[model samples]
Target: MPLDRAKTLQDTMTQWRHQLHANPEIAFQEFDTAKFVADQLKSFGIEVQLGLATTGVVGVLSKGEGDCIALRADMDALEITEQNTFAHASKNPGKMHACGHDGHTAMLLGAAKILAESGTFRGTVVFIFQPAEEIEGGAEVMVREGLFEKFPIQEIYGLHNWPSMPAGQMAVGPGAMMAACDTFDIVVKGRGGHAAMPHLVVDPILASAHIVTAVQSLVSRWVSPHDSCVVSITKIQGGDTYNVIPDEVVLKGTARWFSPELGCEIEQALRKIIEGVGKSMGCDIQLIYDARYPPTINTPIEAQVSADVMASLVGETNVNRNPIPSMGAEDFAFMLGKRPGCYGWLGAGQSEDCPKLHNPHYDFNDDLLSLGAAYWVALSEHRLI
Candidate 1:
């Protein structure tokens, strides 16, 4: 029934999703995206608020006096060039909607229209369109800017499209749903010399390589097999000429873990390894580690509420109540940290060869528009009741 109701708006939602995908924006620079969202909310007769987290949009709809809840969707795109030749492929150079935020935005907008017109739910529903969910913590910025203080919201909810899972299936549960992400930069300094003369000069590249290989042991050998932790050295920059050894080498990577204690231990162990490697190789190492998004943990009550709403839309069998958590980080973790809420994953069925999120060839599955919108509507109606 909810799916049927949501189907009526599928055509329009698909168009909106395509438009957003074509004109992708990144992080706090979602001016056009915010305006489009605000205009849609205005058309739905919902009160709109802007500039919360520098382009974040919030739509409020009140029918009666009861509990106020928030349903959120991220609106920012990634900085990846589109490789698809589709009609709606990204027009913005070096930016693309590879993370399916376009569909997330359109679905929530579609839900706002339905909830605004039907008048079936009591109390208020806050439709939050967040920005900068990829790397920057826009949810944290909104909270610091008094998002909850400005609006009388009790609990919040968020959803993300998962291409790895098949369509018509959903995942929600209590406890950690996503890991915390922390970035580290290590600079190795050594003497410069010709590549042919290895013993004649101290080589930073050799030291940096050892540092990289040594840190991997932190996750594999230091941490227990039962615990999940990741230390990856993604970028390595050093020499300009192949014939000469560079004076300095830079290493950048990220660390992910679910528990705070494990996170601390990871940092300590990583620092020790890098420092030890640098000392052994006679190189000066400078390490810079920044704690980014926290682990996204769902509260039990709201998790059950989300699961029940999802089951109502699809079925008990379609809803995965105990799915394994992901290593991928979400800024929604910031919001869940502040309020009791649950963040869920919506399956976007694609072929096995299809690219996943952040890939240049990846695109949001448009078929999921109706189901996602219906889920949001059902969630609002259920939670507000």
Candidate 2:
């Protein structure tokens, strides 16, 4: 195919994207967005299911008897004010599709329309329009609600827009496309005393400074050189007055690693370092660790399937393998963990003028809409056939 039909699909998607971009909704509050998606799916004669994660919608299209494949797109906007001066800029104050989620939803909807019209594939294609991807774990909630069990999907696929890569290009890797994210808070308790009396009391602020320095050694000295990890102490709060030391000091930060085992090891090491340092300094310490998303590991077979489908649509030269893994996390890992699947990066463009993700000035590239739709359609037909 020459992707001619994809151009038509792109035109439809562009309108949908504009409407969505105009009426942006934040995580878990995508009621109108969900309704819009449901209505579109129903209009296309696809079976629709709603309310999996408050406002998530799933559309099912079946052609013949065979296994099923799932295509997912998140439908949540970020808590950012729109800085773009375009006519379709966000109307919702302090909410914008800076992550290109509007584009993702529109492209998936485009694929649904094409697949429903073509009716060339065997089995079913489940279109997942999920909510709350930026904050709460919507993907996690959907899996818990039996999304896969009800749909019985053999494989699932997700895609995100990458602004750094040139438009029309796609990137995929076999494993660890994104890192595991974990957050931590530490409170150090000590006696409060006047700053003038240096020996009178233990300063928790001093102890906290030591702990921060010690924690850095966990990644620098403990973790292997080849393995990737990040430990950043982003916040520290202690004394309010220069003359008096406070009774406690609080520290907040996050840890990231590419492997689950490595993440666990890092957590254990953090606890030991905090407690060991606090005890030695005659201060009590409390640590709170929250494990967020696990690393997104693409199964080999699924990765190959994604690469081949993308190559067929965009040509072999446009698909990239072995792209560097990102330290950031994605909730899509939850779905990929449950099923054999891969998540690929769709290039938006490579202009320095193009706004990066999460930036208020950023908008999903309308030019890539048809390209994404074509990839989705080709993947569905190829996999089902």
Candidate 3:
């Protein structure tokens, strides 16, 4: 029965997925993508509201007043250039859906179509198509602009395609499903001099080097060994010339932690490290730490619901209720902060050759589209009933 139902929508969903994959857009600039989604929803007889958080779309489908559950799918792509040479490859250069958000959107849309046609569910199901999830915090902006106030949704739900896990399985937990994302930028000012000189200048570059090494201790020493966290130095900019020491060196990186308190702890420790280096080097150092996404914590009850529903869809053996949490951050954390929800993972593949998230060759697994859409339908119906 599931196979036949999925087979009916497989072709249409694949076409929609390919279309979205071919024309990838980035955060806050998903005008075309939002339009396409709205049009699709409208064709399915769903009412859509546009202009929330610049390019967000809300599709409302209601039978009778009871409770509302929102299913969200981010429509923004990354700034990566597509490496796959397939026929459905990205048409826009320097932009691709490396995170499988295209698949996510298509899956939700498939559920909307099935529900609209069959009219099987009760109450209301809000389809949230958000923009700028990659960088602009579209969920945060929507909440600030009264998304809940307008929609009055009781519970929200979201999902991401996890390439590390095999397809046809779901992994979730009650606590932190994903970590908080915080970014830091440090600038050190020092005297400039030629490399040939030994003691003529305070080398900002040297101080930055030490600061980088010191900040790593925040995770290894400041945080507990049992805790899950990451402190990575991703970018550094200082000198352009070959032999001349620059006047200032800039260091930038991201800090990730599953514990909410760990975000502030890392920020404080980062400042201390840079300040201590500045004092020791007798130079000026500035630290800027910005709290981005909060920890994506699933409310216990909702998480249990997700686990139960997915188990019914597949089987108890295929569902993981206590999978390890990811250090990666999600903007859905912002939504979960305001309301109760479960942000889950849908396994894409586990093979070593499978492309991972943010990789240039990464692509959404199309085989999971039917299963994902089924899960969305079952989840919304279960919650509403």
Candidate 3 vs. true structure, TM-score = 0.97
lDDT of 2 by residue, 147-248 (tens): 988888999999999998888889998998988888899989999899999699988988998999999899998899989999989999888987998899
Q: Which ten residues in a row have the lowest lDDT in candidate 1?
A: 348-357
Task: Give each model's whole-structure lDDT.
Answer: 0.93, 0.91, 0.89
What is the overall TM-score of model 1 with all chains considered together? Answer: 0.97
Name the lDDT value of residue 273 in candidate 3. Answer: 81
Worst 10 residues of 2 by lDDT: 1-10
Per-residue lDDT for 129 in model 2?
A: 96
Give the C-alpha lDDT of model 2. Answer: 0.91
Q: For residues 239-321, could you state the per-residue lDDT of candidate 1 as single tens digits? A: 99879999999999999999888988877898899889988999999999999999999999999999999999889999999
- lDDT winner between candidates 2 and 3: 2
* Per-model TM-score versus the true fold: 0.97, 0.97, 0.97
Point out where model 1 deviates above 4 Å: none
**Stretches of candidate 3 exceeding 4 Å from the true structure:** 1-4
Candidate 3 lDDT for residue 139: 92
